[model samples]
Target chain A: MDAMYQALLAPFIDFAFMQRALAGSLLLSLASCPVGVFLMVRRMSLTGDAMAHGILPGAAAGFLLFGLQIVPMTIGGLIAGMVVALGSGAVARFTVQKEDASMAAFYLISLAVGVLIVSLRGSSVDLMHVLFGTVLALNDAALTLIGLISVVTLVALAIFWRALVAECMDPLFLRSVSKLGTPVHFIFLALVVLNLVGGFQALGTLLSVGLMMLPAAAARFWTVRVEPMCLLATAIGMSSCVSGLLLSYHFSLPSGPAIILSAGVVYLASILIGSRGVLSTRNRPSRHRTA
Target chain B: MAEACITFSDLTLGYNNHPAVHHLTGTVAKGSLTAIVGANGSGKSTLMKGIVGVLKPISGKVAVKSGNRIAYLPQQSELDRSFPARVVDLVSLGLWPRRGLLGRYRPEDCDAVSRALVAVGLAGFEKRPIDTLSGGQLQRALFARVLVQDADLILLDEPFNAIDMKTLSDLIALIKRWHQESRTILVVAHDFDLVREHFPQALLLARQPVAWGDARKTLAPENLLRARQFHEAWDETAPWCGPDDAHSHHHDGEHHHHHDHAPDAIHKGAA
Candidate 1:
C-alpha cells in the first residue's frame, strides 16, 4: 500500500511541474466542460471540433512570429477560431452550402495551412510541441493565462445563461419576445473560442476540445437535466485531468494524449455502466410495455 | 370601430425576392380574434413571420401598433425539442421582455410561472423536461409560456397540429379567455370548421387576399374554392416579379384575373 501510494503521489507532491500541469488541466476543464454541455445539447459538437482545429493555423502563425510566447499564440488562436466560425457561418448563409460542409472545408484547409506554416520555419520538434502540447512544462505565465481565461469564461456563461438556453431551445420564439438572439449566439461562440485558445496551450489544438466534449458527452449518460449534467461534466473533467496526469507521471506517456485518453476511457465506461447507459438496462425500468 | 392593432398596406412577403404573399391589404382590429386560413404554400406562415418581424416585407408596409408587446407560438417543428430544459425554466423565459437579459427572478415571477402552468393544465409538470412531454402536453407547456408572456398581440402558427382533441378544446378556451381580455389574437389554422365556430373574423389567403372579414362570409365555399384554385394556379417558374409588377396579376374581375395569368404567361415576359 505504501509503495503504491508513494509511486502515485510522490511525483505530484514533489515535482512542481506535475503540480502545475494538474492545476492547469483542472482550470481548463472547469471553465470549458459546461460550454461543452451546451455545445453537445445544441448539436454543435462537430462545430466545436471544427473550431478547435481552426485555431491551429492562428497559433502556428503566432509561433512562426513569436516562437512560443503564450500571449501571441493565444491571440492568434482566438482570431483564427473566430474567423473560421464566422466565416463558415457566413458561407452557409450566403451560399447553398450547408453549415457542416462549410465548416469541414474551412477546418481541413486551416489544418493544412497550419501544418505548412509550422514546417516552413520550424523543425519537427516545434511542430510536435504545438500539435501535441507540453502540459508538464507549463510555466507561471501559462498558468496565469489559464486561470484568467477560466474566470472570464465562467462569468460570461453565468451572465448569458438564460439567453443562451432560450436561443438554443426556440430562437424564433425568443426573437419575437426580445432582440438578444444574435448577440447571445455570437457571445456563446466567443466563449467557445476563448476556451479553445486557453486549452490550446495546455492540451494542444487537436486535443483541447477533447477536455470539453468528452466529459460532456459522458455526463449525458448520467443525467437529463442541464444543471446536473454541467456539474457532473465538470467533476468528470477534473477527475480525468488528475488521473491522466498521474498516469502520465508514472508511465512514460505524452501528457496531453494521456489526458484525452483518460477522458475517452471515462466516456466509454459511462456508456456501458452509467445510470442510463447501454449496459444498465437491468437496473432501469423498461421503456416499453404492452398496452 | 375599434383601433387597428395591425395594418397591412399592399405588403409583399417572400423569399429571395420571390413574393409568396403579394399585394396584401387589411387591418386586424384591437381585441379581435382573427384566423388566417390558407392552403399549404399560400403564405399563411410567411405573413405571420412578417407580422412578428422575423421576416421583412418584400415591399409596402406592415404597421404594427407601436409599443405593444407581441407573443408568437411558431410550429413545433421549429423548436429544438431535444433541448435540456425544465418546464418551469422554459415557461419563465416569457418574462424576458420584462426582465431583459440579466434581471433577477423574484418570488412573484415564480408564482406567475406556476400560475401559467396551472392555467395550461401543466401545474405538476414544472420539473419535467420538455422532451419528455407528449405532443399535446408540449403544446400545453408552450401555451403556458405564452400566458406568462402577457403580450398584447398573440400570433399562433398551426398551434393545433398533432395535438389531442382535449388539449385542443382546452387551448381554444384559453384563446377565448385572451379574446375576452381584449387582446388581439391571430391564428393560422387549417380547420375552416373550427375557425367559423370560434374565430369571429377571418383572412382567407392564397398567395394573396381571397377574402378578409366576418368568418362566415370570408370562409364561404366560393372563397375557399378561390383560395384553393389560386394556390393550385401558382406559377412555380414565374420570373422574379417585384411588388410593382404583381399588381398586373390582380385585375378588377377576379374570374378573369384567375384565368388570364396562366402558368405559361406568368413565366414569360415578367422579368
Candidate 2:
C-alpha cells in the first residue's frame, strides 16, 4: 500500500497534465451527473449514447483539419452532438419507432461513419488516442475549454430548470400548458450536446456518457428529491475524479477509464448499500427518523 | 361586469397535420361547473387538449380572459410515477410562478402545498414517493397538484379513468368544493351520472360540440343521439388534427344542428 500510494499519489500533485485531467474530469462529472438523472428519468439514456457516437466523426474531422486545437475540435463535436440530438428528436417525433430503437439505429450508423473516416484518413491510432485520452496528454487549453463549456451549460440549464423538470416528469400536460415546449425540448438536447462536447478532451466520447450517467445514478440511492439528487451526484462525481486521478497516477493506469470505473464502483455500492437503494432494508421501524 | 370567461370562437384542434375537433364555437361562463362528456374517440380528449392548450387550434381563436392562472390535472396514465419525485415535490410544482426559478419555497408556498395535500386527504403523504400510491391515491396526488396551482381556472383531463368508487366520490367532492370556492373548473369525464349530478353546465363534444348547455338536459335522448352521431363521425378511422391549425378543422365530423356551421363548412371540407 505504501509503494502503491507513493507511485499513484506522488506524481498526481505535481504534474500540470495530471492536474488538468483531474480538474477537467471533476467538472465533466459534475456537469453530467444531475443532467444524467433527468435523462434517465425521461428514459433518454440511449439518446445520450447516441449523442456520444454521433459526435465522433466530428471529432475526427476536426482533428484532420485542425490537428490538436481544442476550440475547433470542441465546436465540431458540439455541432455533431446537436445534429444527433436534433436527428434523434425528429425521429422521436415523426416516426412510430420508440426512442431506444431509433437511437440505436442513429448511433450505429454514426459510429460506423466515424470508424470509416478514421480508417480512410489512416489515423486509427490517433482516433483511439482522441477517444481514450490519458491524463498525461491533457493540456491547459482542454481544461479551459471544459471550464467555459461547463459555465455556459450550467447557466442555460439553471435558467430553464423548472420548465425542463416539468417536461421530463410528465410531458402530456406540460407540453400543453408551456408556451416554449418545443424550444425547451430542443434546448435541453442542445445542452446535453454541449456538455458532452465540453467533456470531450478529458473523458473522450465513451467515458463522458458513463461519468454523466453513473454518478447521478449512484446518488439516486441517497435521495428522492431532484435537488438533493443533483447535489449528491456532484459530490460523488468530484470524489471519483480526485480519487481516480491519484490512483491512475500511482498505478500508471489510464485516467479516463480509471475515473469511470471508480464512478461505476460507487454506483454499484450505492445500489447495494445506499439509504434508499434497491437492496437496502425497507420497512424499517420508524423510531429513528434522523437515521 | 360579466362575460363568458372562456370562449372558443370557431376553434379547431388536431395532432400532427390532421384535425380532430372541427370549428367549435362555444363560451364557458365564468365560475361555471362544466363537464365535457363524449364516448371514446368522440374527440373528448382532443377537446380537452384544446381547452388546456396542450394541443393548438388549427385556425380559430381560443380566447380566455387575460391574467388567469390555470391549474391543469392531466390523465394519470401519462405521468411517470416511477421517478424519484415525492408527493410534496410534485405538489410544489404548482408554486411555479410563485417560486420563480432559483427561488426557494417560502412559508406561504409550503403552507399551500400542505393545505392542498390535506384537501386531497393526503396530509402525511408529503414525503411519499408517487409510485407507492394506489390508483385512488394517485388521483388524490393529482388533485393536490391542482390545488397548489391556486388557479382561478382548473382543467382536468380524464381525472377519474380508473379508481375505486369511493376514491372517485372523494375526488368529485374535492372538485365540488373548488367549484364552490368560485374557481371555474372544466372536468373531462366519461361518467354520465357523475356529470349530471355535479356539473350544471357541460359541452358534450362529439368532434363538434355534440351538445352544449345544461349538462343534465343536453345529455338527454335527442342530444345523446346527436352525440352518438358526432361521436361516430369523429371516430379513430379518421385522420389526426392538423399542424398550426388544430383549432379549426375536425376531419371526422359533419354538419350539426345545435352549433352554427358557417365556418364549420370549410372545416368539413378539410376534414
Candidate 3:
C-alpha cells in the first residue's frame, strides 16, 4: 500500500508543480466537460474541434505581442474562437457554403497562420511547448486563470441551462415564445469559446478539445440524461487528467498527449463495458425482438 | 363578426425573396377557427411561419392585435426529437413567455405542466425522454405544450400528418375546447374532409389565395383544380419581382386570370 501510494500519489503531494498541474487540469475538466456534453448533444463535436484549432493563431498572435503571458493568450484565443464560430455561421447563412465546410476552411487557415507566427519569433522548443502544453510547469498565474475560467463557465452554464437546452431542442419554439433565442445561442457559443480558451494553456491547442469531447462522448455510453451525463463526463475527465499526470511523472512522457491518451483509453474501455456500450449485449438479446 | 386578430395586407412571404405566398390579402377573425388548405407547395406552412413571426413578409404588412399572445406549433420535422428532455420539461417550455429565461418554475407552473400532460393522455409519461416517443405520442406532447402556453392566437402547421386516428380525434377535441374558450386558431391541414367537417372557414391556397371562406364552398372542385394548376405552373427560376412589379404583372392578361378571380372566388364561397 505504501509503495502504491509512493508511486501514484507522492509526486502530487511532494511537488508544488505537480499539485498545480493537477489543480489546473481538474478545474479545466470541470469547466469544459459540461460544455463538451452540450456540444455532443447539439452534434457540434466537430465544430468544437474546429474552434480548438482556430484558437492557435490567436494564441500565437498573443505570444508574438505579449510573450507567454496567460491573460493576453487567453483573450487572444477567445477572440479568435468567437470569430471562427460567428464567421462560419455568417458564411453558412449568407452564402451557398455549409457551416462545416466554412469552419474547416477557417481553421486550416488559422492553423497555418498560427504556425507561421510562432516559427518566426520562437525557438523549436518554444513552439513545442505552445503546441503540446506545459502542464508540468504550470505557474501560479496559469492556475489562477484556469480557476477563474472554471467559475465563469459553471456560472454561465447554470444561468443559461434552460435556454441552451431549448435552443438546441427546438429553437423555433423558443423564438416564438421570447426574443432570447439569438442572444442565448451567442452566449452559449461565448461560453464554449471561454472554456476552450481556459483549457488551452493546460492541454495545448491541439489536445485541449480532446479533454472536453472524449470524456463527453465516453459519458454517453454510461447515461442517458443530460445532468448525469455531465457529471459522469466530469468524473471521466478529471480521472484521465490525474492518471495522465501520474504516467507523465513516472514514465517521463509528454503531459498533454499522455492526458489525451488516458482519455482515449477511458473512451475505449467505456465502449467495451459501459452500460449501453457497443460490446454490452445486455440491452440486445437478439437482432430482432422476440415479440 | 369578431374583430380581426391577424390582418395581412398584400402579404408576399417567401424564401430568398421568391414569393412562396404571393400577394395574399386577408384577415383572420378573433375567436374563429380557420383551416388553410392547399396542395403540397401551396404556401400553407410558409403563411403559418409568417403569422408566427418566423419569416418576414417579402413586401407586405402582417399586423397582429396588440397584447395578444400567439402560440405556434411548427411541423414535427422542425423539432429535434432526439434532444435529451423529459416530456414534462419539454411541456414546461410553453410557460417561457410568462416566466422568461432564468425564472424558477413555481408550484402552479408545475401543476400546469402536469395538467397539460394529463389532458393529452400522457399522465405517467412525464419522465419519459422525447426521443423515446412515437410519432403520435410526440404530437400529443406538442399539443400539451401548446395547452400550457395559454395563448390567445394559436397556429398549427400540419398538426395531423402521419398521426393515428385516436390521437387525431383527441387533438381535434382539444382544438374544439380552445375554440370554445374563444381562442383564434389557424390549422394547416391536408384532410379536406376533416376540415369541412370541423372547420367553419377555410383558405384554399396555391402560391396565392384560391378561395377564402366557408369550408364547404372554399374547397370546391373548381377551386381545388385552380390551386393545383397554379402550384404546377410556378416558375422556380423567375426573378423576384418586388411588390410593385408583382402588382403590374397581375394586370397582364396571363397573370390577370389567377389574380382577378381570387377574391371573386372567395366571395362565391362566402355567398
Q: Which candidate is the best by TM-score?
A: 1
TM-score of each: 0.92, 0.87, 0.91
Q: Which docking class does model 3 fall in?
A: medium
- Candidate 2, residue B59: lDDT: 68
Native contacts recovered by model 1: 0.82
Minimal lDDT window, size 10, model 2 chain B? B257-266
Candidate number with the higher DockQ (1 or 2) = 1
- Residue range B1-271, candidate 2, lDDT tens digits: 2356677766767765455676677567677778888877767677666666766787676777877777777654467887778888777777774664467778988999999899888989999988888878888887887787778888888888778888888888988898888888888888888888888877777766766767777688878886776434324566544553443434434433232223333343333
Clashing pairs in 3: none
Model 2, C-alpha of B265: deviation from truth (Å)? 16
Cα misplacement distance, residue A237 of candidate 3 (Å): 1.4
RMSD of each: 4.9, 4.9, 3.8
Best-to-worst ranking by lDDT: 1, 3, 2
User: What is each candidate's DockQ, to 2 decimals?
Assistant: 0.65, 0.52, 0.64
Candidate 1: misplaced stretches above 4 Å? A1-9, A93-96, A282-291, B231-271
**Residues A143-224 of candidate 3: C-alpha lDDT, one tens digit per residue:** 8989999999999899888888888889889888877777777777777788888888888877888999999999988876
Over B32-101, each residue of candidate 3 has an lDDT whose tens digit, in order, gives 8989998888799999889888888877778889888999998754578767678887898898877887
Model 2: chain B TM-score vs. truth? Answer: 0.83
lDDT winner between candidates 2 and 3: 3
TM-score of 3: 0.91
DockQ of 1: 0.65
